[model samples]
Target: MSSRSYDIAVIGAGVIGAAIAAQLSRYAVRVVWFEAAHDVAEGASKANSAIACTGFDMAPGSLESDLILQTNPQWENICRALDVPLRRIGALSLAFDDGDSDSLRNLLNQAREAGIEAELIAGDALRREARTAAPSAIEALHVPREGIIDPIRLTVGLAKLAVLNGVELRCSTPVTGFRHHPSGAISHVVTPTGATAVGAVVNAAGVNADLITDAAVAEPFTMWPRKGQFLLLDRAVGHLVPKIMCTAPTPHTRGIYAVPTTNRTVLVGPTAVDGDDRGDKTTDGDTLDAVWARAERLLPEGVERRHVTKTFSGLRPASDRTYRIEVSAKVPNLVHAAGIRSTGVSAAPGVASYVADLIGAEVMELPVKSSVRESIPVIPRLAEIDTDVAATAFTARPGAAPDEHPIVVCACEHVTAAEIAAECRGPVPATSLDGVRKRTRATAGRCQGAYCSVGVSFILSAATGDQPGEVRHGEPGSHWETPVR
Candidate 1:
């Protein structure tokens, strides 16, 4: 029923897809972003061990390593332009035993080959650096390039900037299949809502990417769901670990790590469990217990279960082979950017660069825009803004602050009424409570939606002009089970 067409279509709205769409918007070509979820970053992009690694741990010369190294230094500019929070807090890998000591040396050598400056410290230096590390720790590998980032904010900011640059974003639109032109190149992408014919397509559909390729292309990789469970500790104890704390990797796992988040909290665990069902993001009782135990072992004093604000899990698109980032040889005009594994967030910019190059060469002379808007206006969070800036923001609208007027909603995170309303109607709008949390950190505090859910629901109702019960949580048929519109 839709008559619109695009020169290029991105199939996913995760970090990779959003970055690709944003980068492509630099040109004049028509680019549209599609997401099956109700909002961007509802997949692995929203949850995971959100480390912006420097690729020091990756296999040298692999696709993931190359991309990471190439894009690592660019994050400062990217995050600044996109208005996402990122910091070079670095990481410290502790060696508690002989095997870990050996792995530490190996990692140091690998870091050298990967062009990352690394140092191994022991004795008083190690003790001083890793105050919370296990007492058995002998030495620690410190890599200064690895940092932490807000993954959801990065994804949403990219999607917003892409939309600002004239890229169409379609949430709740699931691509059913791909119809090809006579030349064996993809022509039309069929979705539940409608079909879109495009000159080129990029397959960045996360775990569902293999299914999206269809019978036209034989995928080079097989993707299995690798579940990683995590525990988010409150910000009160976040300062105990100044750098990312971790143990060495095992045969299948990346080991447990406790990293400081951008929001002044700590994220630990992420036990890797391989499974058949891609939709299985549920955490097991035994797995979470082991994860916390491992985290405590790494951090001797501060880590506590009572401080845990949330326990969640994410599914990484795991594969046996290295990351696949190439144009499909089987399907013309289709680029394959799947099986990025745990490194997708760190390597997204590099992935975008490659996809842009491929689309530039393949598209039938898509016109380049004369000018492109690359930056998005920063949304000032009340919790993070300076006193003067907060005053200025509130002065523009006197009722903007919770203290000024009793329009307060999320008291835990100091989110006010005007803020929630703006997020619900932003460029990349929030459709549900969780969406608002991702955009504004309203219900993401210690209360965990306990203190703010009703007020947030009321604000959402008012914002959308829907009844209180009609406002869904994240999507239609969400766990809220509210009546559908």
Candidate 2:
């Protein structure tokens, strides 16, 4: 078996792991990233609320709150540097009755305590300003800094940035075991591919992080999958929900929310159901129906079931504790960045920086690079081509074949042939149809690949040199059977 060595190993290629690896790449350290999935963000990062939270209502002094607050102000620059799409369109928390209004007031107080800007607006004023809001909402809590982002794009961008900066990313490589030194430091990480000798390790494996931790030492906490089912409406309904509309927070969850995606589509639902099965991402009709009912109470009249394009579920790493960002006392070289729940997308930047500090001080010395690439070139998509400059700004990568005729592949989202091929041939190339979809939005539109899957399959077949039937839709062993026609 082949073997390799690295100074540091970051497990899990979800948002948190990607962020941590990206941040670490700026230093003079040899880093290796491992993901069991076929591509990055294949786990919880694949599906989410897509909201860039402001931490305005987070509990005061909590690690989640502090990290969110610390990172919230950096998103504008962060998104710009990473070339991820972000919309600072703000969010509203609607209150249906007196109890909810009081909750809004309490949230406002919490925001004030956290030094976040927030205001409670009367329902009449909210309805006047945000025409899409329901009239039954007695009051609304407005947090102007709350926004929407492309969560998949964000995770991919981070992973790509790390790859560009000399971090070796090993996709489909899950760390199965760890070999420790006599001093109790992790000396090697064992994966199916091979074993890699490492100086330190970071466990950011989402719901499976506890398992990694327990492998080295008895973990103080355990993790379960908190399943959240969501519904994606077509871009036709995007105009109906201009901003994020949220219900009052219950003790267990933030409740169902309706948020606009950067792709100009509206996302609703996310029924937070806790369970022990981390692999059970299946969606039920009854659960989704109840979530849709809650969404209907917040959105405008134009939203209908006909506009629904996709239904998906994600498993967040739910634990008994809050955010766990610490170096393990049992294994001095092991760092824990797990149990980060729903707000992981928003908390990534802060968590990354915090974990980097721990790794530097406790694990090893991370010398800052004299020079680092702060930003990557932005590749404009067909959907984002509005200005004259953007239309004329298309440039093929160094080794990519020039697209003499840019044929439209996904008509629902305006994804072009060149875009699909580019993602498939990217530095972090798309090995599966879902990978291409996350990068280029090729088959994630209104038709949900009904009209575009065949085209996309052909593109993947050509890019990877796979046969028509060998082109996989998503992970390994998910190949599509070509028609007999």
Candidate 3:
């Protein structure tokens, strides 16, 4: 076996792993990233509520609180450098009753303890700011730093930047096992292709992190899957809520939240359900109906189920306690980043920096590269293009190869065939329909790929040299065999 060695190897290409890999690439180190799935961010990263959380509601003195507080400011810098869409649109945790209002005051104190600056807005001021709030809500806590982000774009951007900096990313490569070298503190990771040796390994595998570490070293903790399902409203209702609207915090979950996405679509929901099932379960009609009922109570005239485009679910890797980020005491070179639940997306950049610091302290002579490329290539949006720019682009690349510029395939989201093609041909290219959907947003709109699935499948077939019948949805081993009528 021709063995490959690296300074660091990160298992799982979720948001946290991608962020860590991207940050590690800024230093002069050989980095290898492994994903069990066909693409990056296909797991918990793709399915969350997509909120850039401020540390306002995290448990005080917890790892999540620390990371959330540190990452909030770091996001602005990272988003700007990477061209990831992040809006500091703020949030409102509305209280509908007097008891809830009292709870809000308590939360304010907790927020202060967590180092989040927030204020309680009441009466007309609260009404004026968030007009869609239920009339019953007499007060609200306005967390000014809370924001919304495109999680997929952020993760993809980080992975792409890491790739440009010479980090080798291997998708469809699941690490089945690992062996510790007897002489040195190195590990030989076994993948589907072959084994690769590395000086150190970071287990950031979201829900499956514990399983990855179990075979080699004793896991420090365990992770439970907390499923959160979300409902996506059409763009027509996007203007009704200006900021991320939410309910008073609860002990089990964050409560239902209404958020306006960067793409001008409003989203609501994420009813938390605890389970061991890792697959994205079908959105139950009953669950969605309950969510909408709550949403109507929150926004009154703002929510309409008729405008509902899609519903999806994501699993959060909740632990018995708080998030765990530390090197294993049993294994010297192994680091475990597990139990990263809801706040992982917002806390990812800070987590990356923190992990880098930990890894750096152990290695004797690791040097930061003076000339590592910090900037990410910009992805031009078709919706953002003006008439003149569109004309110029069309002229530059004619319609005969119409997929070169922008051929609007998904009319609901304005996703172009070119964008799908580009994502399919990327460095760590998309291998399934859901992968394309996450990368280019081809199937995530009002129609949910009902009208455009065939076209997207054809595009995938053409791009990957696969037959039309061979193109599957996001999950591996599943194929789109049914011919489109």
Candidate number achieving the greatest TM-score relative to the actual structure: 2
Point out the worst 10-residue segment of candidate 1 by lDDT. Answer: 397-406
Q: Per-residue lDDT for 158 in model 1? A: 89
Q: Candidate 1 overall Cα lDDT vs. reference? A: 0.83
Top lDDT: which candidate number? Answer: 2
Q: What's model 2's overall lDDT? A: 0.87
Candidate 3 local lDDT, 74-114, one digit each (tens): 88888888778889888989998887788789889988887
Between candidates 1 and 2, the one scoring higher on TM-score is: 2
User: Order of candidates by TM-score, top first?
Assistant: 2, 1, 3
Candidate 3 segments exceeding 4 Å error: 113-115, 183-186, 386-400, 481-485
Find the 10 residues in a row with the least total lDDT in model 2. Answer: 396-405
| Tens digit of per-residue lDDT, candidate 1, span 239-307 | 887889999875666688998899998899887888999888787788888888888877657567899
Query: What overall lDDT goes with each candidate model?
Result: 0.83, 0.87, 0.82
To one decimal, what is the Cα RMSD in angstroms of model 1 from the true structure?
2.7
